[model samples]
Target chain A: DTAVSQTPKYLVTQMGNDKSIKCEQNLGHDTMYWYKQDSKKFLKIMFSYNNKELIINETVPNRFSPKSPDKAHLNLHINSLELGDSAVYFCASSEVRGGAKDRGSEQYFGPGTRLTVT
Target chain B: DQQVKQNSPSLSVQEGRISILNCDYTNSMFDYFLWYKKYPAEGPTFLISISSIKDKNEDGRFTVFLNKSAKHLSLHIVPSQPGDSAVYFCAASDLGNYGQNFVFGPGTRLSVLP
Candidate 1:
């Protein structure tokens, strides 16, 4: 079974269009995160949700919004997508909010969604 | 500023040889360090990790070493295989921040040749 999964493995859209990427985790984790990997392969956290509560919001553009309907799902919605937004977006999940002594805090990653904004 | 850095952009090693990837961090509050492996079109997978209090942690063929005083860490793979070719990422987190803020290095690509 897939521990973590994201919809739209590949996305191509025009600039100024709105798009959404959905993610789900079956690991029963309490925290889920959204990360963007640029062409340079630099992975940076964009948003983090713990038990459906927004926790970490990086300096991402206001056009980017993340909504968590439950502990198992976190969806990212981007408005007015820009060409600079062309990159891979990843969804991750962990068991706890804080550092777990056993490193069970390790984030389980999805296969990643490659978004291309024209 | 980039808090975590992997100075070497790429490294090549022969199969059956040892592979060592180095990483450095400037944030003193980072209490946990981890190494991840990634292939093209896939997200990173956790490999190993070491706590600030411990200098070394080993798991089978992979070993992670942390030098708290030097603010450095390294991942060593024994008997490297061709399948080991992938990008490696070094990440650090401050436990005080609930581990929410993890800074990752740009990454180091390892090419293991037969």
Candidate 2:
């Protein structure tokens, strides 16, 4: 059983195009996150949502927006996609203990969505 | 600045040998650390983790050691098998910093050859 899943494993689009990637987690986790892995293979967090509430926004570009319709789903939408946005986007989820967000909780990740903006 | 760093890009080890992967961090506030392993076309999965209070945590053949003073940690896999080959990522998190938590390092690919 897949704990977390993302659609469109491979995405190829031209510059200035708008696209969206869908992610869903079945692990019943309260926190969901969006991460972008650049060509340098550096994975950085873009957004995090806890129980349908935005908790972390990592200063990502304004064009990139993350929407969490529910606790189990977090979707990423990019407008006017630029060549620099070509990279693998990962979706992850975790259950954070209340009043102890500092503790490390194992994050379950989905098979990344590879976006290529030509 | 990059808080977590895995200097080694890749490492190779023979079957039944020991494979050690090292990670360093610059952030002194980071109190929690984790190790994740990923295979091709797959997402990273949690392997092990250690807190600042403990120096070592072991699970089966995998062990993680943390040195808080040096701000360094290492993952050791004893009797590594061919299936153990994967990309290993080191991640660190700071207390009370929810937005900046979960800083990850560029992963190091490990190849366990038979």
Candidate 3:
């Protein structure tokens, strides 16, 4: 069984269009994240949700919003996508423990969603 | 600012040879480091990791060495095979923070020549 999974492996849309990427994890992890990899292969974290609550929100554009219906699912919604939004979007999940340092909790990533805004 | 950085954009190595990938970090608060490997059209997979308390960690043919003083770390793959040819990324996290936010570096593409 796949530990982490994302839907719509590939997304192609015209500029100014809006879209959403769905992510699900069967690992029963409490933390989920969204990352964007640009053409230069630079990966950056966009958002993170812990226990269905928004935790980390990097200085991303207002158009990009993340919604987590439950601890097992986190979806990214992009409004008025631009050409610059073309990139590979990755979904990852990690297990977190309170008090004790969770340094060894390795993140498991999904296959990724390649978004192309023409 | 890019907290984690991989200076070498790409590297080539002969099959069965040792492949070393380097990473540097500027944040002293980052106490844990991880290495991930990614193939074309796929998300990166976790390979290995190391804690600040330990300078070295090994798993099978993969090993990671951390230099806290220099703020540098490296991933070594022994007897690298063609199947190991992929982009490798280094990530770091602040142990003090419960958020577990990871900072990743620009990946280094490894080409294993047969």
Candidate 4:
């Protein structure tokens, strides 16, 4: 069983076109994240949600938005997709650790969705 | 500015040898550090993590060491097999960040030669 899953493993689109990638986790985690892995293989955080509430937005472009229906799911939407948006998008989740005051930073990641904008 | 960095882009290791991947960060407030391994066409998998309070943590063949004074951390793998070859990333999270937001390094590709 997959702990975290992303839909449409490969997304190919044209410039100025919009697209969305979906993610889901079954690990009963309360937090979900959206990350972008660039061509140079640098994985960076774009957004984060806790219990369906928006928490962190790492100075990402306004054209990009994330919606979380529940803690189990988080979806990323891009408006007027640009060639620069072409990269691997990853979804991750982690539970709130009980003992640690810092919470759990051990994230479970999904098979990334490779988005290509032509 | 890149707060976290992995100076070495790649490393080659022989079987049964130790593979040490290093990471450095500029932020002293980071409370948690983690190491992740990734194979092609897949997302990073968590290997091990350490809290600022502790200097070391180990799991199986993976061991992570943290030196808060130097703002440095390293992942050591002993008896590295061919299966251990992958891109390794070191990540950190600060207490001020929400929802476990972590900053990642570029990554270090480890090739374990048979």
Candidate 5:
């Protein structure tokens, strides 16, 4: 059973085009995240959602938006994609302990979606 | 500025040998650390983790050591097999941000030769 899964593993689109990537997790986790790995191989967090509520929104451009319809799914939508938008996007989920002792909970990642903007 | 750093971009080791991957962080606030292994065309998988409260954490052949004073951590793999060859990433998070702001290092590619 795959714990975390992403659809449209490979996507190639022209500049100014819009695209969306879907992610789902079966780990029964309450927290989900979207990360972008650029050509430099740096995995940076773009957005984070807990129990269908936005918690962390990084300094990402307004063109990228993340939506979590439910606790089990988190999707990323990019508008007016540019050449710099070319990167691999990953979806992750983790169980939060909550309260006082919110230690680092290891995250489970999906296969990743490779996006190319021409 | 990069809060988490993995200096060595790549490391090569022979089969049955021990492989050590080091990571350093500039943020003193970081209290929790984790190591992840990634294969080609796949996402990173959680390997091990250690909290600032402890200096070392062991899980089978994998062990993680944390040096709070130096703000450094290392992952040790014993008898590394060829299958262990992959890109390893070091991630760190603080209690204040919880798991939302996990800063990941650039990653280091490990090659286990037969």
Candidate 6:
């Protein structure tokens, strides 16, 4: 069974177009995250949600928004997509077991979504 | 600024040999370090991690070494097989941040020749 999964594995759209990517996890985890991997293979965290609450919002542009309808799903919506928006997006989940300040927060990742904005 | 860095961009090793990947971080606040392996067209998978309090941690053929004084960490894979060839990423997180707010380093691609 796939622990984490993403929809629309590949997205290609023209400039100024809007797009969205969906992510889901079945690992019974409490926290979910969205990350962007640039052309240079530098992976950075963009957003993080715990139990449907926004916890970490990075210095990302306002064009990108993330919505978590439930604990198991976090979807990303990009507005007015530009050339720089072209990159791979990844979803990950980690459990907060036995409290202890969320120690050993090992994350499980889903297959990435490759986005291309012309 | 890049808090985490992996100086090596790529490395090649023969099968059954040991592969070492290095990573450094400028943030002294970082207490947790992790290594991830990624294959083409897939997201990264967690391999091993070590905390600042410990100098080394081992699991099977994978081991992580942490040097808090230098703020450096390394991942060693013994008897590397072709299947182990992939892009390895080093990530760090501080206790003050929310759970696992990892700062990732630019990845290093490894090629294991059989």
> What lDDT would candidate 6 get against the real structure?
0.91
lDDT of 3 by residue, B23-99 (tens): 99999988889999999998899999998889999999999999999999999999999999999999999766666
**What DockQ results for candidate 5?**
0.63
Deviation from native of the Cα of residue A53 in model 6, angstroms: 0.8
Q: Write one digit per residue (lDDT tens) for candidate 2, span B7-87.
A: 999999999999999999999988888999999888889999888878999999999999999999999999999999999
> lDDT scores for all predictions?
0.91, 0.91, 0.93, 0.91, 0.93, 0.91
Per-residue CA lDDT of model 1 for B4-109, tens digit only, reads 9999999999999999999999999888888999999888999998777789999999999999989999999998999999999999887667636778999999
* Top-down DockQ ranking: 3, 5, 4, 1, 2, 6
Reference-based TM-score of each model? 0.97, 0.96, 0.97, 0.96, 0.97, 0.96
Tell me the tens digit of each residue's lDDT in model 4 across B1-114: 888999999999999999999999998878899999999999899999888888998899999999999999999999899999999999998755556679999999999999
lDDT of 4: 0.91
Inter-residue clash pairs, candidate 5: none
- Docking quality class, candidate 5: medium
- TM-score (chain B) of candidate 5: 0.97
- Can you tell me the CAPRI class of model 2? medium
What value does the lDDT take at residue A40 in candidate 3? Answer: 85
* Pairs of residues clashing in candidate 2: none
- lDDT (Cα, tens digit) per residue for candidate 4, span A1-118: 9999999899999999989999999999988999999998889999989999988898899999999998899999999999999999999999766346445558999999999999
Q: Give TM-scores of chain A for all candidates.
A: 0.95, 0.95, 0.95, 0.94, 0.95, 0.94
Q: Each model's DockQ?
A: 0.59, 0.56, 0.63, 0.61, 0.63, 0.55
- What's model 2's lDDT at A64? 94
